[model samples]
Target: MVRKEKLDSMFNAFSIVSGGNYVYVCDMKQDLSRWSKSAVDYFGLPSEYMENAQSIWNEHLHPTDREYFNESINAIFAGSDNNHTLEYRARRLDGEYVVCVCQGVVIHDDDGKPEYFCGSIKNHDSVNYIDDVTNLRSLYGFLDDLKSAFWKKQELDILMIGVEEFSRTNDIFGYTFGNRALRKLGSLLLSEFRCEGQVYRMDGTKFAVIAQKSSIQRLSEIYADLQETCAKEFYVGSDRLTLSLCAGALHLERFSVSPDTVYSCLRFALHESKGNHHGELFEFQEVVIDESRNSLTRLNEIRNSIVDECVGFELYYQPVVDAKTEEMCGAEALIRWRNNDYGLVPPFLFVPILEQDSLFPELGKWILREAMICGNRIRAKYPNFVMNVNLSYAQLERTDFVDVVLDLLKATHFPAKNLCLELTERCRLLDVKLLQNIFVRLREEGVRIALDDFGTGFSSLGVLRKLPIDCVKIDRDYVLNIQSNKEDRNTVKFISQLAEAFNAELCVEGVETAEMRDMLRKFNVTSFQGFYYSRPVPIEEFCVKYSC
Candidate 1:
């Protein structure tokens, strides 16, 4: 049995962590009650309610829940149960319904009659289950609801929605205003799905909806509504923002799957929908399982190879040239994997998988060491030549990242001024202050920083204004059509102007055709890199051709 002192302490601790949770201590003989401050404020109960707490509970509980609530209490009083736990929807002072979980233990007097009940009531509206920013159910709450649905064998249509370019939004407007946009999105979802489903914040800029058993046509209609709604402009702090979102759906009745499997399938479908349907919804297919299984096996094999360093992993250098002179100015290091089973693995197939692994740090360091050593040799012939190496977000987050780079430069006898680190748009989750400090220290050491995949990501005018970068590598998407597509040409022209304003050099990558290179030069872009010059080749070949 829990003593009164222990119950008091538990109640005190519970009130602090559970948001609007309230503890009630009832004296049956005295017919009196006391409530935690949070509970009184949340429910807006008058002082008179303390005198008749039992009546107030019945009055506030929904009519459908009152019978169950009374039965549970009666069962405990009658000695059929030691305690009672109730989960039901109750009416709040605002005439809104709130799901609540309440558990109570009855204490008996010496005569065996119930003397008091100790209970804690948690309103689901509290932040314990809802996201503070979105006001939707959080991941924890989503899991709980999913479990309950599984137990009840209820059919649910699940959708996973992801905000495209959300990271760019945060980078440009700052996270404070980013949260406001998320809140607005949450409000929009709640209003639309109030009678259809429950919206949950699955992760940063990702949301999930669990809808009641509905027809496939209805689901499609809902998806279309969401897509159209999100396409409109968002008003945030004097700035109007346009956003895009993609969604993936899983029909629960079609298969028997665990909660984890549901999450995986939805995520995979979501990824496939990207650039496939232009933010439209994609349904999970049977092939997803086979693909996921094969992918995991391949990922495991590659992870082991990276860790053991037994697989043939090598770096190839592609030359970056001056547009006007057609002279090589620098080289970007690219990785290749020669596996006995897979033969040759292209980066598009393996790099994304590896970068998601924690062990990528080891691979990244290996690349850095090997690239710098090779670059040092190349520099012997051309002292002004620079080598650019891509840095993953994982590598940059390491506390020892800056130190490792500095040490590599010292060990390779490579000039820091000639070794550039390229950060890509794939780095979405970043600590801005931490990255800025790291960049500041690196710049002090004479190391150059470059932003790769420039026009493709959320690289806004604001991010360029704040980030301490030395170069911008325009993504191939923009450069490929710069000569033929007027929009592409205009985007490149604007980016070139921004680079000039920042005093940063612009290197237009994927410059395959003479027309593309010539068009970029018109915008005053001098540095170019792509197949037009040479595909990535072995160090020996690079040394023989460029004599470096």
Candidate 2:
């Protein structure tokens, strides 16, 4: 009798604290002790209904939750552990089920056997388990949950964006500046998107926004505005910097049939944004989805190649001949892959894929090693011959790249002067100081540095003043129609004059026609390369033609 009195007091205290119902079930017997007035009101049970609480309560439980609720209660009563927590649906008098969370503790008898279970039940309608700001979930977790919730209600549109060469900016300006820039971008996005959606910082250099269900046209308009906003120059500590943003957007209703499928679709859109420049926005289209699927399939095959160390990759050498003497000066090493089943895949198709993965470093090392061996083989015949190898942004930024090159030269017993490292202008813009250091060290050892595709990127006159370079290869676009297009001719002439001012040899690429060649010659261009001389060919073929 005393125990029952104490239990009733405990129930009353709980009811007062929670402002809700409380129940104490003793050993699964049909009778329950101490029901609260709030419980009666919440369950919509009359005063008379309390006499037979078990039957009344059983009828109020949602059909879907009835079995689980009963099972959990039984388990709590049978176990020695005093705690039980569960979420289930409870039907109201109107036959509507409301979600509820129940927490309870089991009371033990003198012998340590379960005697009764006491618990409090609360309505969970106001609780948002997925999006409580104080919970401090990770960025990825937040994005996943946000995507799922919006997709579930069919109320989401997503945009993914990345700042181009984000790594380079971080390297040159330090992460402090990079982070501040990103934060400023985040603030801008929040101000612009908060009224219509939620913005999430997806990763170090990527961001995503979720908009309520909207038309494709509306999304496109917003995306264009966002592109414009992102393209504007930012001033980081008076260092005026212009960074490009590439964006991809998708409507939740397009490919996502369920909330869980939204993330995958968003990822597909994000991947499509790679290699795009500022103001470039790619919308989610059926073709993109198909291509993404195909690319993923190919990615698996590429992964296997890395594991086996048997990348069926081949090297093709494009001769860079002296324009005046018509003598082959050096060859640019090009890579091509031919799978047994897929046949030949172009470098443009697979190189980007490799760049996106960890395999790029290994593949770059292989290319360097193979090119050195082949170049040395030819050098054996012509001691003064040189070879140029293209390096990607990833390979060049590696701290050990200089060491790798020096080691390769020593191993091959080839003169460092016989190898030229060709980098695009964009690569130079990455970290002018670091690249200068690398180039300076290489130049000190007699290795030449050539700026490849000079006019295509952020052409900083400051770069020429800072770095020591031996040659500047004008991009093929400027040379393509120079003979016919006066603008192209003038651009080439202007670049040629600048090269002369810098005391750098100017090599014009893609000189296919005699007229283009003559134009380059007239502009005082010294070196040239294109199909007119020879397309990239096998080492054996190149050696047979160029060997002295």
- The lDDT values for all models are 0.77, 0.69
Q: Give the TM-score of candidate 2.
A: 0.58
TM-score, every prediction: 0.52, 0.58
Model 2 local distance difference test score: 0.69
Q: Judging by lDDT against the true structure, name the best candidate.
A: 1
Q: After superposition, how far is residue 519 of candidate 2 from its true place, in Å?
A: 3.7
Query: In candidate 1, what are the lDDT values of residues 1-548, reduced to their tens digit?
Result: 24445445645655566555678876555656667866676666775238667677777787867877777767765667768767766777788777777888877889988777667887776546778888788887887677557645678888888898898989998999899999888887787677778889987788888998565456668778877766765566677787888888877753234455466567756765774677878886443324234443444456667768636788899999987899988899998887666666667765753564557889999899999999988888888888999988779889999999999899989899999999887664476677788989999999999988897544666667778989988988887767668998888888888899899999988988887777788996869999989999989999999875
Which 10 successive residues of model 2 have the least lDDT summed?
129-138
Question: What tens digits encode model 2's per-residue C-alpha lDDT throughout 1-548?
Answer: 66666666766665566654455434333345556555667668765224445556767886756766677655665574468666666776666666676788776678876665667777754444322222222255544455345323444567776677788888898888877777677766677666666676765576777777455566567766876655665565577667777777766444223233344445445555654433466665532325234443444455466556747778999988888987877889998777776676567765644554445778888888889899888887777777888878778778998998899888878789988888764364367888888889999999988888888754556777788978888989887877779998888888888888989998888879877777788886878899999999888898788653
Candidate whose TM-score is highest: 2
